[model samples]
Target: MGFFKQVFKSVFKNIIDLSRPIFTFENNELKFKINSEYYYTFALNNYETKTRHDSYILEAYTINSDNLFVEYVHVDNDVTWNGLASSFFVNLFKEKLPINSMKIIEKKEFEHYEFITYKINDEFTLNFIYIYEINKDNFIIEKNAELYINLLQSFQKDYKYKFDKNQDLEFDINISIVKENALNGYFNLSN
Candidate 1:
């Protein structure tokens, strides 16, 4: 009877584990935190290339269908992040993208945080910021208070861009952030 009870408990535990979500999001001050069972998988799935080492993993993915790329780094040390970000910007200067206009509008570095803003075009802008010495446990916070504001103008527009057939054709379009990491790096789509 004891053996049967043990087996049942094991089966129940496995069932619960299988139902867990892959990724969860929590809002920070002005940014967001992405937590996942397989953070590496989540990073690799979105990026075109990856640089892995014992201390850190750096992955870069392109947005706007390969028109623009951003490199994100996951490291325990602050120095590693600073080095990677510097190298990335240096490379950007050497090899300019095919975009019509690209320029760095602002760059700032503080004791605990650093950020760079790039103006891609007249309509879009890209901002990258890193904060150090942050509390990893307090991942979520909420505060609501409205200040006096004025509405200048508001409008909504929709546009679609077509991609070439050979470029990223095998990518999964309906990938769920919560489900992808649960697969344990076994991506079904063929590349």
Candidate 2:
């Protein structure tokens, strides 16, 4: 349960608005929350990857209260949603690629879809996921993102960017939120 809870928190932190609608997966069924806009989704199938990276494929759907949209997604390699959106797939190599660089080897484009391939340079790798769309010629990001700092601890542990042991990893992204949205929606963790 803690694992799922972490996943939920990670998903939530990536979004800026808590008031908008959110959904989560449960017992193979999609549940929706109007106020908190929470959604829980677990990988139903392993996503296939061609690049030599420590990446995981996540396939989940946005469960809707209305039956107007597709209810089930078999295997979605990239993130998907029905709204004004934006996303990018970033590759993080275990060993910083000799000054950090990525090269796209392939790109497939269709009427309403696009997929790009990148050549990773190091051992351990992470696929930073972000996907977005343009609506009415005005592009707005439907999702906010927080990089997983835990994955970089081995690299930044003694290096020290800022903060202390007490600060949440999110502080790496936005330190101020540590006081406003403490783990429980308030500054209670310090106590």
Indicate which candidate wins on lDDT. 1
Worst lDDT run of 10 residues, candidate 2, spans 136-145
Query: Against the hidden reference, what TM-scores do the models get?
Result: 0.27, 0.22
lDDT at 39 for candidate 1?
23
C-alpha lDDT values of all predictions: 0.30, 0.27
> Which residue pairs show backbone clashes in model 1?
none
Q: What is the C-alpha lDDT profile of model 1 across 1-191, one tens digit per residue?
A: 99999999999887765544322222311222222121211111222332223222222122211222323323332322222334344344334434466566555554334444555444344444433332111111001100000000000013121211122222222211112223333112222
Best candidate, TM-score-wise? 1
Instruction: Mark the regions of model 2 whose C-alpha exceeds 4 Å error after superposition.
Output: 1-43, 46-99, 122-191
Q: Which stretches of candidate 1 lie over 4 Å from their true place?
A: 1-84, 87-97, 121-123, 131-191
